[model samples]
Target: MDRRFNKHEKLKSKKLINKLFTEGQTVSAYPLRLVYLPTSLNEANTPVKTGVSVSKRYFKKAVQRIRIKRLMREAYRLNKSTYFNNLTTPHAFMILYIGNKKPTYLQMEQAMNKLFNKFINATHKATSDEKNT
Candidate 1:
């Protein structure tokens, strides 16, 4: 894979976004919360599609919100391979930055790692339960 965060990898469809938020499962690690739905929304070649959001209610300024989102996306892009390699199905994810104050990249990266681990575990468990039944 290219390991690049490109336009095709971005989750932008309004309909898909609505379904992702409404029907998805949530996982949180401190400042970050991920809402994900396991479905094949992306093309056959792309295994996952992701969206990032930082609340204006918390950041107030557009610059602050954009900065936080940048950090979040960078963290996720670097660490997403681990998630994709282990997945049994494609997932649409919305990563929400919920912190009230600004956070450093290291802090956000750690939180992103934790969130991904939690998500992987949850998906693994769900698949195993399905196999047993």
Candidate 2:
């Protein structure tokens, strides 16, 4: 409800990060790819924790990588409610910027919107299947 990206809402645990990359489901919208896994940790309070990454292979410069990551984070922060509001379980998410070139904020936002929609649908389907099983 605060709609603010806070410290506690950030994915920081090394173990969880490793698990997320290794075991999470992925959804891609061109320049943006989302890796997410349903989590039980801190389920009663925080429903989601997110991290953003930009590949060094694409952006050799740290500044460029940081800028891209910042853009992705801003987009996700602004639009996360669309994905989070419908979530019945907690999740850890990694938003990876996979473009060869830097994207405009508008472009990143659009991609993020698509990625979030895909993620929401996938999550809902998974939850429903679980319920039916």
Candidate 1 per-residue lDDT over residues 1-133, each given as its tens digit: 5568888889999999999988999999988999999887648777889999998788888999989989999998898876676566778999998889899999999999999999888888888899999
Model 1 regions lying over 4 Å from their true place: none
As for candidate 1, its clashing pairs are none
lDDT of 2 by residue, 1-133 (tens): 4678998899999999999999999999898889999888764778899999988897899999988888888898899876687667789999998889889999999999999989888877887898999
lDDT of 2 at 32: 85
Worst 10 residues of 2 by lDDT: 80-89
Query: What 10-residue stretch in candidate 1 is worst by lDDT?
Result: 81-90
Which lDDT value does model 1 have at 81?
79
Clashing pairs in 2: none
Clashes of 1: 0
lDDT by candidate, in order shown: 0.88, 0.88
